[model samples]
Target: MSTVQLYAWGPALGAPSIDPKCVIIEAYLRLLNIEYTVVQTNDPQASPTGELPLIKDGNVWVAGVDRILTHFSMRNQDANASLTPEQRAVYLAYNAMIQENLYDCMLYTWYADMTNFVKSIRPTYAKLLSFPGRYLVPVQLKNSAKARLAKYNVEITSDDTTLPQNEKEEMKELQRTGWHHMYKLARETYASLDAQLGSQKYMFGDSPTTLDCIVFGYLALHLYPDLPHGRLRHILTHEYPRLAEFCERFNAAYFSREHDVSTPAEDVPSLWKVLVNNPRGFFSNVKDDIVSYMGTDAPKEKSTAQIDFERKRIWSIAGGVTCLLAYIIWNGIISVEFDGEQGDFESWDEYDQEEVDEEL
Candidate 1:
């Protein structure tokens, strides 16, 4: 009998949950083949600690992904129990990278890019809410995300006008520089992951592990999402093909709903290659980053709505001018004395004039 119920944010954009913590914990449960029911909710107030992705077992509740995983591990024994101490250390390090660094990058990618937030993230509320609830909830979530990013020294602006006159340009420059650096850092993390994943069937090899679940949570979102800002996605799919392959391999094994598991040739970088390429790229990126810090990337183009508004404004002005000129001519507002009857000018449209004349 299943007595455990997992509470998490509902699916959005075809994902099981937009919350990585929730997704990872769910993946862990699946990996363990545990029987549990999911209870989706939008309200954080429903949770024991006012945070999401909690698990309820009988009368006891466990809050948070890490705590929940720990609880399951203590009860059922960790999937990573086979990992040696040194391998476990490496796994923990990568898990931390996903949780602390990659998680923030995901948030910034979703919230900082307004196009994505409006197009994909915002509409998610309508899936589970209505009216003002749909409107207010997304705003609250976006604001909360911004605050979290700010805590990590990531600057976010809801509007350009919110900054001071002189500081607007400066802040924009800073944002561009910061995002480029942030993306670069994310790439470095992926490269490390590519190296770590190697030819192993799992993170440590042979069987699935806790680290594999953690990595899957982050990697799946990075690869699967049709994000507005896809720098990280491109890097994952192209720059680190091995990581991409690893994701595919893992997906085929556990997530694909098939029971067959096959070991494929993992593209692990050689020791010399890692030693050479990593440090060489580090210093090169450092030099490039210094130059990047001194400058900014080009500003993004106006969104579709903004561009449409500008186009409409231009057409409106042109139409208004044409209407004014026609009004003046029709009313004889700009007339001069002529050798012809003034009313004759109105008969230029012969078809309409003939019809009116016949009616008269």
Candidate 2:
């Protein structure tokens, strides 16, 4: 017996409902022939964190797509459904890219840009920023973010309630464009998926892997756009027919149940593609955002821990103090690059890599 249960959500009415997270979990479970149950994520107030897509397995509970997929992957590993070693590496890489790069972009759109977004989504929520302690929202809004960040990690008190009008305006501005960046991320991520799917039917191969499910759920929310005024007509379903086909196939085969209230399985295909509509041109454009999303906030060369290292390097280099550290910091870097077309260099001895660094 499979201990797995899926939590799902969708539109309140009108549109055919689909939750990508639910579909991804459903796909992997069925493909692996694992047993599981499904439920709606319960909530009296609709918070950004999750009202849907939180699953409970006995005492162990996890929310969001990544955590849910990880839980199920740990449990199921049949040969037909298990990821190949090579596929496993790629899956991890892709999933990481989605979480760090794509999700950062998504949240920046959802949280940072979504004042208007929040308002647009307000109907979905039972209440507004009644999210405990409202005053700090304005404080975080008006000043240079650095000043407000001082408040971060500290508990908010009732005294923080009032804010200057300007900051309130700023907060509203951030909310307006939240969806734009996500639209950018969806295009970029979808392109990556299309390229891979065009190469092979499944994300990893003919058989779907745990990675595919992770990629599928979040993308579905954006592509399907069951929400009014958010549907992505820009990502023409014609551009990548195969990916659309994959989504449709999953919807039809896995979710087409009569009793399901959220999204009818019959409409899964259109709903699936509609969520993450475009990718080819979109993914290629956000090079800076992607790199920034991956990197830490510390300076590229200097860090909080080694502030003195830069000062020491500058003094040594300028004042004719020929210290060993200066040379080590500026003199050299070691790198190896390979092109697949040349030949396979899987082993160390084959490539002759003698690695030495100038010691400080």
Candidate 3:
């Protein structure tokens, strides 16, 4: 049998990938005892869905953790194949809850929180890129995360522009409200998961299953990374020791390879070199970002209201991007060129006069 090729984000904090989805897929592969080679990359363009943790088996490419699991299931390599019908139903319910609730908390910690982003998340992901990308990609990711949290009616902003004292106090109050909401939700989730574990080695039984892999993936991120404000970690370690122990045992069994499989450091090229050497690839990434922002390929199973909401989101994002670009260019933070030269008009006055003369 040919070896499978797994393309994932670079490793950090003794994990295969910083992404929980990537870690889940890698753990599943190891649990199945599959032979695979890890390809560390910082670019999501390697996947058809413009996401990480993709696999290439023979000539077939599979993207997304769920899709990869389904791919293996078709080949009779399912981890949960032995699960009874009742257990399968429970697994589905728990999986949805974990992905939606716990995953959002993880996002809030790493991206939504300014302190954690600056202290840990930014630096970890920055090492995977070079030059301008090292500076740009992290911000882009944080914006995407903030957008996701907005769907849950949670808002956080980093608008540091000068304001009146009263306005500044109000802004801080709003941020505190958002933070408290996230903390409450995360605490409830940990308590529920702790009660569910209840002295069991795994979530379901003694042997590990798909649910175990997913749980460990999220738990490892919460426990392992040294974040500035580790509220989630504190809760798990102090209140939910069972879940902490589960993570330790799971990590020892699956991730403890005799030979270190940590990704070797590679020299990433500067943004300029990336654009000059691989212009097509660079534009491909831009196109992917636009498509992701628009979300036009959303699942057809969505309701009419959901589709309409997506349409509205697309228009709003388009307008926001336009205004942001205009602001940046106007302030000389970014420059634009036409015909391989900077535009001749230095100000709107010059542009208006040019238009008037042309009309005359």
Candidate 4:
């Protein structure tokens, strides 16, 4: 078999990888006993999705952790085979919750928090790039990040200038209160997960599963990085000691190789260089290139099972819409009545005796 090559952000915190998505992919590779070479790149455009942690196997290049995992699992039927149908459902639910909810909180912590961005994340970028790049790239990325947060309506830092001074302070207060609530929610989530884990080695007992890799990626990345806020560190290390140990164990077992805090930027083709050289050609061909290599369109055709699932999904949505429309119509009809002496007025209850008598 041809070597499977993984392109991801390089190691950080003495671990194989630090970017949460990269960590998840690397951990999955380790769990599957797949020997792969890591091609570290800081450039966002290195992957088709403009993300890190793409994998190339033979002629195939897979982007995103989910897609990469699926690619491998399709060949290795035994992958996640131990998980019963119920367990798989639980795994998917938790995965979505973590990816959607917890990920935003993590972003707010690292990017939206000016303290962490300046003291921690900024310096790393400085080391990773050269001259104007060190300054320009970080600022561009930070601004883009803030824009994303604003797009998502996540709480903004006090430093944001989009609002008036008074409103900025209000936003900051809201941000603080929101973080507190988010932290509490995170604690509860971890507590539930810890309870589920119990004294077991993995999330589902002794053997490792894809879910374990997913959990480890997020938990470990948040805990290990030297962010300005010690809240996550304190929670993981003190509040959830077992979870902390789980990360440590996984790290030791899988990423025994020595790795660095930053990768040399030279390895990645500069985004500017690609744009300047190819310009229109680069943009035009990129989608086709990715599709050709991936051997599928943006979304591949669904199997019979998947088709059935989608059909059920469509019906479920239609049913929900139907019920909601019926409810609105019923409420609208029941709430008001016409009268000759009085203009239209509210009838608070459909079963009101007076209204019933008047109707009769």
Best by TM-score, which number? 3
* Candidate with better TM-score, 1 vs 3: 3
| Per-candidate total of colliding backbone pairs | 0, 19, 0, 0
Q: Show the lowest summed lDDT stretch of 10 residues, model 3.
A: 351-360
Model 2 quality (TM-score) = 0.47
Preferred candidate (lDDT higher): 3 or 4: 3
lDDT of 2: 0.43
Q: TM-score per candidate, in order? A: 0.64, 0.47, 0.70, 0.66
lDDT of 1 by residue, 29-141 (tens): 88888867777765554553546677776666777878898888888657877889998888888888878778777777776755556567666665675443453446556
* Model 3 Cα lDDT, one tens digit per residue, 225-309: 8786677888888988899899999999998873224342232222333333444454455566556545444344544643553
> Which residue pairs clash in candidate 4?
none
Q: Identify the superior model by lDDT, candidate 1 or candidate 2.
A: 1
Tell me the tens digit of each residue's lDDT in model 2 across 1-360: 425555554333221234344555665666666666554432311212323465556556665665666676576654225656776677777877765554444334333333323333333432222322121122222222223223322112211122224656644543343444555656776788777777676776776666666555555454454432333423626555666677666556555653332322221222112112322222222232234223345444334323442344234333332332244235432223468756442333332332211100
What ranges in model 1 sit over 4 Å off?
151-153, 159-177, 257-360
Query: What lDDT is reached at residue 351 by model 3?
Result: 21
